[model samples]
Target: VCPEDSNDSSRFMDLWYTFVDPYATEVDEMGTDEANKSVGVLRIKDGRKIIDAYEWKHDNDVHLLAQNDELIIYELHVGDFHEKFKDLTTKIEHFKSLGINASNINSYFFF
Candidate 1:
């Protein structure tokens, strides 16, 4: 269920993948004494339910970046670079040839 946050319009308002129940199919509106506003569970393009409520833990002992200056990050929009995700996978070799060790995709590509 999307607990609306107190933020301006520029900020993200809708909850993408917050609390999720694998057995449940819809969210119940508990505070709807005047109007009816209930919605079904959110799913991905492949029709699988989304569950991102798990807390992520990172280990710093691995030393992902020994030196910040040594990092070569390449940012790109998947839709703009290629229309399909399978097509983008074919460009991995191309990015490696350009010395791009890390890649970042904008969140807008998912929504």
Candidate 2:
């Protein structure tokens, strides 16, 4: 079940206690009352719930390098590409021949 469907507070609290509470050292020390304020809670009818709470620290500010017009988008299925082209370089060459300046090929799951 997805976390977005939960609407019950108690079920959300239970989920927070079970999944997030175990790993949350900061929240544990703060006690349940105070912890409830800081952490988001959700409840579901089908016995599914989620606690959307975490400390996400970013080392640096995010910078978007690619602009809208500058981006060259290529959408293709990995399985289809693999079945069609046996070699990686050959596929890139084919894209190059078709006037594609830069080919962004996904190396299966890696790239």
Candidate 3:
């Protein structure tokens, strides 16, 4: 499976490609593999080097603190926590463990 080891068929540089129809139903219309049909990263297989930068990393240091109307509030839909009283109590304790306020996200994920 080594390209450089065997020095097999000669290779040449080719143009990077994408398709108007991503699925590529016709022979003329080329497309990516089914697994790469959606938005994600592309890489060079040899050294696991990333050549495509579709999505960039987010800045983790940014924080926003607002007052009154400027401040955004979040309401969590606590379903499983609402089921058992002990779960709600434990969930509250878990939320308090985090420095900032957190939500109960175990309830519904739509999955």
Q: Which candidate wins on lDDT?
A: 1
In candidate 3 the C-alpha lDDT for residue 80 amounts to 52
Task: Give the TM-scores of the predictions, in the order they appear.
Answer: 0.40, 0.29, 0.22
What TM value does model 2 have? 0.29
Q: Write the per-residue lDDT of candidate 1 for residues 1-111, one digit (tens) a residue.
A: 333674454554453433445565557665354343443465465687676586658755475653678879988777876677787789999998998888887654475
What's the residue-level lDDT of 19 in candidate 3? Answer: 39
Best by TM-score: 1
Put down candidate 3 lDDT per residue, 3-109, tens digits, no spaces: 67667666655665543444322233223775334443334567765444356567676765654555333456556556665666675655555543433345455
Worst 10 residues of 1 by lDDT: 31-40
The clash count for each model shown is 0, 2, 0
Off by over 4 Å in 2: 1-12, 15-66, 82-88, 101-111
Higher-ranked by lDDT: 2 or 3: 2
TM-score: which is higher, 1 or 2?
1
TM-score of 3: 0.22
